[model samples]
Target: MTFSPRRPLTAVLLAGALLAGTAGCSTFSDSGRSKYAQGEGKPAEDDDASASASSSAEAELPYDIRPLLHPDKKYYGLAAKGAPASMKSVKEFASSTGKKPNMIEFYSAWGDSYETTLAQNAWDYGALPFIAWEPFKRSLAGIAAGKDDAYIASYARSVKTLNQPVAISFAHEMNGFWYSWGTKKATPKEFVRAFRHVHDVFEKVGATQVIWVWSPNVINPMPKVRLEPYWPGDSYVDWVGVVGYYARTGPSTFPTLYGPTMDQIRAFTKKPFIVAETAAEAGDRKPADIKDLFQGVEKRDDVLGHVWFNFDKEADWRISSGPASARTYREQSRSSRYGFDVTKP
Candidate 1:
């Protein structure tokens, strides 16, 4: 979903509850917002038992995910209306495309705790949970100055306790002017500082399970904005997520839409790329655009995969928007190289 100035009441209330809860515990008073509004973990046992259980769970799951970091196959992902929160969107996407997504993308505002249920559910369904962490409530300067350390540390600790591999795209699309952390609102230096600070906090908490994805909107629309200044360096990121769309007026082909951005990014870093957000607009060109998108990722060795923005927000971006588009998506997405059981790498 694109950035909107209007905040959701459900998300606001959820964040408020999280802020009011105890910071030291993994369990939150609320389950956060979800499509079906499911509960999170079971009631906490004694503090010692909870810690022991968390340790055992962490031991059961391997912390070293370097092997899966750069897999041979490209990952297919989806960002639907109610994603990681519930598998309903993913299941519907799978039914339409004939292949379940290897990565499930969702959005979370600042001050919200980690969605443990979402992570666990995605893992159980054989997909990796990808979070677009938006810092809507605070300024990048404030975050970099350690004003939000309490919340950041709390969130990092919760992630560590879960001990699941998660892909986080923090303050995404900073190169754009759409969000609070965007070009008009925050400087590039402040953005980089805040990004590195967040990464360091996660490191301090031993949340090595996270795959830090530094995402920026495709530079096609904003040719004047440079990406290097916003970059948090290679060590601070695991993947470069490029966000773009195939709209009716702008660049339609992959070369014009994402190629330039990828080219610019390559000048600075050789990190693997993921089309973090993309979808063709609903119209006569939708089917062809879908074909181009799948082919574009398939032919590239550096592009690890793509995450289709499956919502109908400004335009009908869903694959099932039309019969032709639906058929084309299912046909083009049938490539054996698209998805895999994330757990098995």
Candidate 2:
């Protein structure tokens, strides 16, 4: 969930630069979204333990994550910075926005396990955690040929063990050329093979707890590249997560940034779509862009939810990036369309 190509930086420049740099509640991260989840473990609030008891390391999941990936349900939340080492720490962070996130997103490298302390924290808090499982180090061709099976298998086992429901966006934004697994490094055939292979292994391990998401960056980055070729088929994905950003100077409306990608995905899949990552730069139009984003998503029946990349890096992508941006975000998030509720009772 990053913004490397989030804005209107020409796609070519973004790909060349992202060899350079990088959401929402019903909650998002880019540039290794989980890169910031490195906080010291703190004791969960007194009730956090009890609240999450059902989603314990061994207990069966208490809720279904499939709905978040459905073509109709709505979700809203943030890609919070700074990891909370414990469920308590996660809860505290979730509350910082004055509203709990229903969806929590992060990133993972090849070696990280599927069921993490952070995942547990998120599940305990009643938020459905989504992971951008990257295929770094290992190429898509190698993954298609079982090169990362050991790592994939271990992660699959971990998900089965956790038993709680979560979403996994494997090799996200593959159409973009910036990352190793994207257009620059792998062909559409190789990407599909790798995706199915991973999904197959997960199936073998009985990791039904995972909701598969096939996320892509804005098509603007690779306008000439047809996204259809990367499709792993309807069976392989449960949701479509798209990433985009409003530029400080370029087209900063929801329609301009996300419309093209949506129009393309709809032709092929009926799966629900989620704004896996999006942010408006801290500029004159940030507030308006924020309004447009929420308003647009609210009116769309196909969009199930959106994840705001609340951090500030190349651009102040945070909700509080501008004076009224944060307030606008809150009002929009509280709207009826924003189906955020991590602490579901």
**lDDT on C-alpha atoms for all candidate structures:** 0.79, 0.69
For 1-345, candidate 2 gives per-residue lDDT tens digits of 354323233442242111111011111112211221222132233323443442342133222333344433367655756532444433553454456677777778777776467777776666777888877788899999998898888998887766566788888889988778987889999999999999999888767767888988888756898999999999989888888777665556677778888899899988878888777768778888888998888888888778877766655677766668877776766676566443331
Distance (Å) between predicted and true CA of 141, model 2?
0.4
lDDT of 2: 0.69
Q: What TM-score does candidate 2 get on C-alpha atoms?
A: 0.79
lDDT, candidate 1, 52-148, per-residue tens: 6655442433244564678889999988876777789889899988999989888888999998898788877888889999999999999999999
Q: Which candidate gets the maximum lDDT versus the true structure? A: 1
